[model samples]
Target: MIPVLFLSTVLIWGTTWLAIALQAGPVPVLVSVFYRFALAGILFLFILAVTGRLRLPKREHQVWLVAQALCLFSLNFICFYHAVHYIPSGLESLIFSLSTIFNALNARIFYGERISGKVILASLLGISGLVLLFGRDILDADASGTLTGVGLAMLGTLFFSLGNMVSRRNSREGISPVFANAWAMSYGAIVLMLLIILTGTPLIAPPDATYLGALLYLAAIGSIVGFSTYLILVARIGSARAAYATVLFPIIALGLSTVFEGYVWHWTGFVGLGLALLGNIVIFAPSRRPRRTAPIAKDAETVASS
Candidate 1:
């Protein structure tokens, strides 16, 4: 099941950037985002409701849910959608690969986890990789588009990291990820709707088959199925292990970009990808601890139970 879920999520998400690119004509970014989440939210809610698995949040938990919706569903995606306009989808995915680093830092800050040397090293490696990956682009005077896209991708990854922290909170509070996600996605759609209304963005229907197909793929497979499986993987294997999938996403996205989008690659690009993946490996490697003496066994159980 783990393998199945992992592969499914990777395939679905690896292809989603192209779907998002296909959605880029005539319709506004916000509107396209709204459509994807709205359909997904509604369908997911209905499915959960029918299965008798829906869980309502308490007043206190509702606040966290709203925050999760904002970070995960609304703002992060908006940044990504706008970002794809300025850069290749593969490049955007490469930037998003930094989410693993961001997640660890946020965990340190929010949960008081000790900042490990590996985390610091991972950050530096990832940054160096980005510099090497965009080697000439960084020096080019006319590279505003790439720079801006990288900035947006970083901002979006930050939002995603924060959302992971929020999800951990929900998980700790005995809320199911699927339940929280279904509700949060619905809340996310409403938020996007309100933003559209406030900004007075023109509402438009899908203008062609490409737009409609992309919308369905994104709403159903990308948002609904992809997120559900990924979160479930987080629950089962722990986040550190589950993040292994994310390390491969950029690789697959790059393959697609090379084939479909005619993206060019160089030696620096290969080296940069190696460095970045190595950073993720270092960051997610299981921590080593001294074996506990027999005397501490009961105390360990007590702490875990408490």
Candidate 2:
């Protein structure tokens, strides 16, 4: 089950990056974003209602749900869509992959989770690998756009990590991930609509098939399916481990970029990819022995008596 969820997330999200790049021209970014969640939110609500799985969130859960919406569905995506304008989709994915490290640090701060030494080492290796992958791009004379893209991608990743914390909290409170996501996406769409109204970005749809197709794909496969499977992993495993999906997905994104976007791979890029994947392996490798449970004198005595 874990493997299924992990692979599904990687394939779905990996492909979504190119879809996001497709969403760029003609339609306003905010409007396109709103379109995605509005459609996805409607679909999720309809499915939940038909299945009798939709329920009103408790007042206590509502606040975190709103936070999740703002972080995960709203600002995070806005930053990413805009960032892709300044960078290649594959490079954008690599930056987003930093979310694994961000999730670990955020989990440590918010949930008192331990950051294992191996996790820390893996994060460093991953960062180094990314630096190698982007070293030439960074050294280019006209790299202000690249820097801006990196900054936006990092901000998006931070928001995503924050959202994971909220999701973790909601899971502990027994809120269904599907239900929470439905509401969160709805709220996020509402927020984006407000932004569009405020900024007066015209709510015009692009008549282009490519843009419309990508939007539908993002709404259905990317937002609804991808997020549900991922949050389930967060609930079943830990957020830090679940976020390791980011590490693996970039390889897929790069492969797609090579095929579709004419992405040229250097030997250094291959080495960097290997290092990044190695980092994931290091973080996920099983510990030698499980932590010991507390000694139970009564159980021991009962066993002896028997």
Candidate 3:
């Protein structure tokens, strides 16, 4: 079950980058984001209703749900869509991969979870690998634009990490991930709609098949299926471990970029990919410790003898 969820998340989210790239023209980016969650929210609600699985969150859960929506579904994507305008899709993905580190840090701060030395080492290796992969782009690109994109990507990653914390809290509260996600997505869509109205970004749909197709794919597979599985992983595993999916998915996204976006692969990029994958292994490698057994009491042993 764990392997299935992990691999499915990597494959689904990895491909979603190309779909997001296809979402680039005509329609407002914010509006496109709005449309995605709105449609996904509707679908999730309908399915839950039909299955009799929809749940109403308690008052306390409602607040966290709203915060989760803003962080995960709203501001994070808003930053990401804008960030990708200035960076290649692969670079954008590499930056987003930092979520593993962010998740560890945020989990420690919010949940008081101890960070293992291996996790920290893994994060360092991952960061170094990303630097190797995109170091040339950072040096060669327009300074202001590159900085803006990197900053936005980092900000988006932070929000994503914060959302994971909220998801952890929701899990502790015994809320089903699917139920929480449906409400969070609905709230996120509502927030985006209000933003569109306020910004006066015309809610016009693009006529191109590419854009519409990408939107549907993102809404159905990416937003609904991908997020549901991911949050479920968060519930089953720790958020820090679950977020390793981001670390792994970028490799797939980079591969797609090579095919579709003419991303030239350097030798260093291959080395970097290997190191990043190695980091994932290090982070998830199980710790070895002998299980302690309870010592039998003398009285209990004597009773058994009698």
lDDT of each residue in 186-248, candidate 2, tens digit only? 999999999999999999876689988998999999999999999999999888889888877
Q: Put the candidates in TM-score order, highest first.
A: 3, 2, 1
Q: Would you estimate the TM-scores of all the predictions?
A: 0.82, 0.90, 0.92
- The 0-to-1 C-alpha lDDT of every candidate, in the order given, reads 0.80, 0.86, 0.88
lDDT of 1 by residue, 36-91 (tens): 99999999999988998866778889999999899989999999988877876556
TM-score of 1: 0.82
Model 3 lDDT per residue over 177-287, tens place: 899999999999999999999999999876688888998999999999999999999999888889888888877877887898888989999888888888878887898
Q: Give the per-residue Cα lDDT of candidate 1 at 41.
A: 94
lDDT of 3 at 141: 63
Q: How many residue pairs clash in each candidate?
A: 0, 0, 0
User: Could you give the candidate ranking by lDDT, starting with the highest?
Assistant: 3, 2, 1
> What residue pairs clash in candidate 1, if any at all?
none
Write down the worst ten-residue block by lDDT for model 2: 135-144
Q: Can you list the residue pairs that collide in candidate 2? A: none
